[model samples]
Target: MSATRPPMTAVGADRLRDELEYLKRVKRPEIVAAVAEARAHGDLKENAEYHAAREMHGFNEGRINELEAALSNSEIIDTERLAVAPRIVFGAIVDLVDLDSEAEVTYQIVGDLEADIKKNLIAVSSPIARALIGKNEGDEFDFVAPNGTKTYEIKGVRYK
Candidate 1:
């Protein structure tokens, strides 16, 4: 991991914590039981059930460790505590209008871990997010999307 801490929204951090808890408290025990059951019926040389159960156990443990590391290395940012600002910023919900198509869309600037395009959550380091940052409501700017260059007008910017 880099020495610099990666930024994560408070909500994202909470979600990771919940997943970690579930893996440790629920999934881990379940996998352990499955492995034990498989072991009881196992032949040492060619035990498919035992091998499958062990593979699942390894995957689950790896995920648990990944979640733990992510939580520990992240800088959790709380959007609710941020002072409401007119300019777009990290964790800000921004409303934008495509200049050519006149289509309106909403996006929340979030950390990499929490970014889900389907959910309108854009990563802070994304091309659009980088363009959106520091822009105020009604500001229009050109963005070089993968498709082509497009202009977008900031319709609104809210911290929460």
Candidate 2:
């Protein structure tokens, strides 16, 4: 069976590796210890602690499996190897100016797994990122937000 996984940048791959390591070395052991301690209390049916521990262990195992599969199938793209133009691309840090307010906002276009809106890291598949892709500086793009259509001008694009 062939499975297709989403592409990931080198930085995103590294972050996933770090998370997997933490889950394996720290979280897994902690959950095991908790389960063992809960089991020692004897009554299995009414053991709230045991049930909670089991639930946590289940979640941890599921996350581990997911991370493993993603990492295994990931096509790591190294930004340094790409001879891209001064336009939006995966792993590019883009600066945009709100046309209406004239306010500047910066976003790092990353893989889906690494996209954190709070950190201003947008996924390549996001609406804003999609509109920004292949756009050079001074190019204006419109976004269909929930409020209304908003336009933004590309101020800059950096590889770092």
Candidate 3:
């Protein structure tokens, strides 16, 4: 059997692609120039600018490699193209009500790379997302959080 690739949203994959393009086409060349210019100035031993440029180059290359690998191993799921499903799944924008706080919040279940709590995007592997998975609207589930266990009721699920 083939290995299971990580599920990533189409938006996430596109963003990574854009970043990779910028790093390779723009950042890499800028770093190369900086390093060359630094090297031209003086001796190699005590050149702080030269070392900094080399470090920046290394970081840029490492990020490029990481993005390339991640993109290669990802399965991009376009929520806009998928039919709406009953259960909360990847690419689902979940509307939930906190049992304790009585607060309503919306979160999109996304890949780890796309998760940002501030933006209301939760990773599929996250505790809340894990508990929310396979659950339908009006269903309640308890999930373990960093603070404590919390209960939430699924209010709605939308693909877009």
Candidate 4:
């Protein structure tokens, strides 16, 4: 049996690709130059600059490999190309309201690598997103948060 690949938005995939390209085409060469310059300074045993450059090179290469594998393994979902639906799903931008505080908030369900809480991009596997999935607008659900259980109402759900 084949293992299911994780889902990722097209925007997230593009961002990872851009980072990979930058690391390969720009950071890699810059680190190479730094290593060469450090090597000219003299003995490798006591050269801090050489050690730092080598460490940076190793980290850059590792990240490039990680990004490549993630991009290849991910199932890119383009929200714009999908059929619009009221129910929440992967890559759906959802608008929600706090029942207790009456506070309004928005979040986009994304892949693990793309989830940024500061930007309100929630991962599909997150507690809130899992609760919101398959639910329609006007539906209410109770979420057990770190603070406490909070009741929320789905105000809207959009594909894009």
RMSD of each: 2.1, 1.7, 1.2, 1.0
- Which run of 10 residues does model 1 get worst, by summed lDDT? 41-50
Which regions of candidate 3 deviate over 4 angstroms?
none
With candidate 3 superimposed using the best TM-score fit, by how many Å does residue 130's alpha carbon deviate from the native? 0.9
Write out the backbone clash pairs for model 1.
none
TM-score for predicted model 1 compared with the true structure? 0.90
Query: What TM-scores do the predictions have?
Result: 0.90, 0.93, 0.94, 0.96
| lDDT tens digits by residue: candidate 2, 69-113 | 888887888876766757667778888898998999999888887
Task: Please name the candidate that would achieve the greatest TM-score relative to the true structure.
Answer: 4
In candidate 4, what are the lDDT values of residues 27-60, reduced to their tens digit?
A: 9999999999999999999999999999999999
RMSD of 3: 1.2
Ranking by lDDT: 4, 3, 1, 2
lDDT of 3 by residue, 35-110 (tens): 9999999998999999999999999999999999999999999988767566778999999899999999999999
C-alpha RMSD between model 4 and the true structure:
1.0
- What is the TM-score ranking, best to worst? 4, 3, 2, 1
Residue pairs in candidate 2 whose N, alpha carbon or C atoms collide under 3 angstroms? none
Q: Which numbered prediction scores highest in lDDT against the true structure?
A: 4
Per-residue error (Å), model 3, residue 95? 0.9
lDDT of each: 0.90, 0.88, 0.91, 0.94
